[model samples]
Target: MEEKFDAIVVGAGPAGSACGYTLAKAGLNTLVVERGKFPGAKNMWGGAYYGPFLHELFPNFWEEAPVERYIKHRKFSFLTEDSALSVDFTTKKFDEPPYNGFSVLRAKFDRWLASKAEQAGAIVASGLQGDDLLWEGSKVSGIKAGGDDLPADVVVVCDGANSILAEKAGLRGDLSPKDMKQGVKEVIQLPREVIEQRFNLNGKEGIAWESLGTFTKGIPGGAFIYTNEDSLSIGVVVQLNALAEKNVKANDLLEEYKQHPEVASFLKDGKMVEYSAHLIPVSGKAMMPTLYGDGILVAGDAAAMTLATGLALEGANFAIASGAAAAETIIEAKKTGDFSKTTLSRYQTRLEQSFVLKDLETFKKAPHFLENPRLYEKYPEFVCDMAEKIFTNDGKPREKTMKLLKQAMDGRISFLQIIQDLWQIKRSI
Candidate 1:
């Protein structure tokens, strides 16, 4: 295929398909290349798709999109060996149109999204591995894939976190383990009614549960479970740097988390359907790579767009937003027929003006705060112990709340450490 196209997007994940779909919708020749058998065939997420990016492209997307469930319930937990302390919330407003988020299985969701690009006149080539950027002097002019050179006026790299094409094009440098995370997950199948009963959900309603502490063996990471139609997605994500210190494998961490009483009870009688491992970019804006250059623009995880603020881990929304922004910038560049760095620099400006960059910048200090060992270690233990102490009833005289808190915290964490962590959390979030 020697045909020169207007735009070639590598990796048909959220970012690539969003770009390709937008470009195609605007009457531009767009081609999306995916390494897997199809889009989402190799992709995985924690089952949450946030934001209205999809709604912007296809109004009322949930009506036909292969969404699992609208998230109406949310829970966060702190875990110790034998106890759990949690905060739970659910709202009826979240179940209506333009819901907050939905649970999704990438294999199905990505394929449906890529089909939208195809329907919009974009060519989606699956099973095509993007090997390297085809360069003309200092600028990328095309993509080299499966021994064929596919030319395009612009190349958008959205090939995920460890984007080899982006790195080879000098758009980003090597990533530090400190800024990366390793995730492993299992998809467990259960009866639809069983799922509803287990998670306490009604029709089309779902829960997103996240926990820290014992799950990671004290690593700087956490575990999550999202309810699907007839299944559950359970996983653990640990910092790459902390993996070595924790001396535990990703699967091992997941296994340990599964044995926790609170988690295991939900999975009873469920059959494991799939298992996968992935690399996650956890640092927010602080580690974002160069956004644009010459005829090439990088979006999604390639630009380190994931946000790992303790309260949430967000990527798909950012990817979708960045992808749309890249397409807009490319549209502007096409108007002038200039794909140089000066023209493509508009992509950076667009992102800055959008929530993609703003949210990242807002939580720029989050990665450091999340990395504090005390959070996943002593803090959770202390909280859980305090909860256990408060709830446990004995014949002996009861201790005051302050005394109970002191007892749980003393020797586990220093007083100064608690104050500092609280201050850091305040400043970071």
Candidate 2:
């Protein structure tokens, strides 16, 4: 089709759809070209959808969007071979009107968000993967897909992790294995009532858990369990090089994780329903690519914008927010009839101004800190050993805590090493 659009969005994810929806709603001719058979047909997430950002674009989204549950509690457990040290936070505040966040299946959510864009007049066309951006004198002019060229004044590539377009456009360099994370997750099924009673969830209120410490077999990765209505999303995220070097199968690690005394109980009656895995970039702020260039802007995972080291993993929120800012920038450029590098640069400037970039910048060292090996290996074993000794009652003589601590430290780590770890942690976080 020999046609042109005001903007073309690549990838029908949160970021792409948000930009498409905003531009279309503002009456800009927008086209969303997705590679998948349908929007979100191939996306996988722990299924957490933070609300306000979506609500800002589609008010009353909860009433229309396919949501699994409104999260009421969050739990993080540090697990060892046979034990777990955990922390939990629950509040009814999340149950109120403006809910905090909800569990979501990316398959349904991505389609729905794209549909919203379609509803707002954006032409969301699927099965057309944006192979590359069409250039006009050092500036992006449009996109080429499936032997057909679709022209656009501005192109927003929300192409997700392993973005081919970003590299083709010289927006990102080759992604190193060390800079990526391999995530394997399974959706396990159970009767709703059984799940509700077992997890202490009433109605749609659910729990989320992130685990570390020996879960990755001394590898720099972590495990997690997220509760849904009648199923649970459980998985592990390991740094690529860590997993490759250990020659560990992600499934095997998952099996061991489920065998842990703390994890076993949760899977007692649950049956595996679906298996999924994907790689995410999480080398911290250093891995993020240049956000924009002449006539083109990148958002979402394509830009390596997810915060993997936090109380909760954040990708969708950043995706939508950056997408919106990109749309805002495009609108300004459109008004001025200038899609030049100088005018389009507002995309980068605004992203830096937003909390998405700021937070990613702030936690820049967090991924490296979390990958320090000790947090998941040495400290956990040490902590579990201390727990065993402190709980033992038939000791010949009660040992002082300091003596026990030093003894524990002496084996694999030293006092100076622990202190240095502490210092590095303080500096990173």
Candidate 3:
């Protein structure tokens, strides 16, 4: 007879580990499976995790977690071919305890998080791929891995954005390219003091910078630079459909972005340490998979919980929240000895009542709004040109600001179009 567990979580990423941690802490027999040699070995991101979700889970998690730096500064820039305009902000409040966010290498963070689940009594099985689901009739019963069946009362699907289990469970179909973003990042090593001095920081203070413009070649995505303790994570995230339509490569765009004067100034002596690429689910409510079914639940990227408003791209917190909610729903089901779809559907209700779904629903229009081509092409050029005209003192009679604005708008973008775009931005973000 094969041993069965109360719950099995597929994928040891943020969602899976969080789910396993919560379930095991609740005294349930839980197992977490990861295809990678360890958690986060196959993961990559811009190197930042925001919000208080981790604190809620571990209470001052940053103290013991392998966090690089706390973000005290943020910069957003619009880059034209040869010029840049930016908005930079920093505050002492973000430097206080329980900071707003921190920069982290997923290779370190995910392993630590998986360890937390393990310490809480969840059996973490690394390098174990969950190839298929075991079903008894119409209900999910367990997972089949390495030609062996591991039975469980419930299976939490936290696989990833490209989750095969989600499709096998009839929760979602093949993901559309138009709804995904491809991110390519390079971890550039710099001295810790050099990183702090270059980005203007002191003692664990860090920066997250995002740029939009010709770098992506009008592909409806952007570039990012995040400061780690002794390194920088620089990358570009571009829309998949747009990349194909424009016949452009994301890595080429990253090279172009790196060569930009504004960006190069910060990377003078850095050594390239790591390179990675991954897919992101940009469409929030648009591509969301079915959250629950009989004997199964989906969370994190598998459920399309990422939020990509033009101002920010966030997903880790949503993943953690959804994982906890899934565990909570299962705990309730265990009490009633009912693992039916009706009982598991409380997972969706719990998420709906929490910040996860509320935020995604609130910014549901953002993804479509960000798809506008003008944002990646014309606006950056117009803004930079207008700023240049305003600041340049050529010893001629000065033109009014409105005249410079009109000059910038001429042949690039119309005032009515700007008004409409502004309105769209208002509604979307």
Candidate 4:
């Protein structure tokens, strides 16, 4: 006799683990399958997880999770070749219980999250690839993994940005370079005290720093530095289409970002311990796939659940939220013993009612706004130059602030262009 489960979750990342944990805890027999040697073994991100969904699932999870630090400080910088203009914000509120965000190493965190599912009675099968979806007529029945047909009532596709299972189920079509971003990252090890001193952090409080400017060589993405317990997660993310048009490699851009004066200062004496790269689905609703089908649902990057508003970049929270919603929908369907499209459609309804779809819809124009070339090129240069002019001591006579602003915009942009850009920024973000 063949074995069967109530649910089979593909990809043991945040989304898969959350769904599996939720289902198993709800008394449903769940199975989580991963292609990597272990959960998160092949995962990489900018190093921070935000929002309150995780706490809702596992209260005070940070108390036992492999989290590196609670992020209480955030900084955004606009950089030129040798100068940088930054906005830094820190607060004690973010340091309290149920902290706003945390810096985590995916390899450790993913395994820990998967273990949570296992502890909840879900059978987490790592090193097993979910090859394809088993179907009966038009409905998904289970998964084909490691040459075995593992039958299940419902299958949740939590695979990463390139999800073969979702594609095969006709949930998402081919992803275009225009809708994706390539991220290259490195984990540089440093002493704990040294890291705290350099980043101006205390205890487990950390910082997330983002930069946009010449470092990307006019690419549409940006650079980020996240503080960890004894390491720094630093990297560069760029739009795939823009990178190709400029004929530049993502890794080469990352190397250039590290060599920037302001960036180099933070990584001085740090030893590189790990290097990784991954793709990000950044187009929000524009690239979103069909969320649900008969006996099938997609969450996480597979469904383009990431948000990339100019002011913030988020994904983990959305992934976890979608996972929870999917689990709830499945649990409800289980009660009726009907795993058809009509029953599973509740997954989309749940997402729409939650922040997952709501936030994405609210910022649906962000992707188009972020693609403006001047944002990655001319704006940073103009801002830094304006700052230099305003603060220079060698000036014979200091000009008014508006005059300096005009000087900065002289050759780079026009007043009308600034107005237009600001208007778009307001509309999008």
CA-only RMSD, every prediction: 1.0, 1.7, 0.7, 0.8
Task: Give per-residue CA lDDT, model 2, range 1-429, as digits (tens).
Answer: 488999999999999999998899899999999999999887898777764777777777888888888888878777888877778888779888568888888888899999989999999999989998899989999999888888999999999998889999998899998998888999999888887888888998877778887868888877888888788999988888877788988888888898888988878878998899888888757888888888899899998889866454688889999999999999889998898878988888898898888888888888878778888888887877777677779848889998888776777788888899889878777
- Over 1-429, each residue of candidate 1 has an lDDT whose tens digit, in order, gives 369999999999999999999999999999999999989988998888888877987999999999999999899999887788999998778988899999999999999999999999999999999898888999899999999998899999999988998889886778898888998999999999999988889999999999997767778989999999999999999999888765779888899899999889999999999999888898877677788888999999888899889888999989988998999999989998999999999898898898888899899999998888888879889999988889999878999999999999889997899899889989998
Which has the better TM-score: candidate 1, or candidate 3? 3
lDDT of 2: 0.86
How many Å off is the CA of 19 in candidate 1?
0.3
How does candidate 3 score on lDDT? Answer: 0.94
Number of the top candidate by lDDT?
A: 3
By TM-score, how accurate is candidate 3?
Answer: 0.99
Per-residue accuracy of model 4 over 1-429 as CA lDDT, tens digit each: 998999999999999999999999999999999999999998999999998889989999999999999999999999988999999998879989999999999999999999999999999999999999999999999999999999999999999899898899998788899999999999999999999999888999999999999888888999999999999999988999988888999999899889999989899999999999999999999999898899999999889999999788888889888988999999999998999988888898899899999999999999999999899989999999999998898949778899999999998999999899999999999
Instruction: Supply candidate 1's per-residue lDDT for 36.
Output: 97
lDDT of model 3 at residue 130? Answer: 93
Worst 10 residues of 3 by lDDT: 45-54
Give me the displacement of residue 424 in model 1, in angstroms.
0.2
Query: Which sections of candidate 4 miss by over 4 Å?
Result: none
Query: Could you tell me the lDDT of residue 81 within candidate 2?
Result: 87
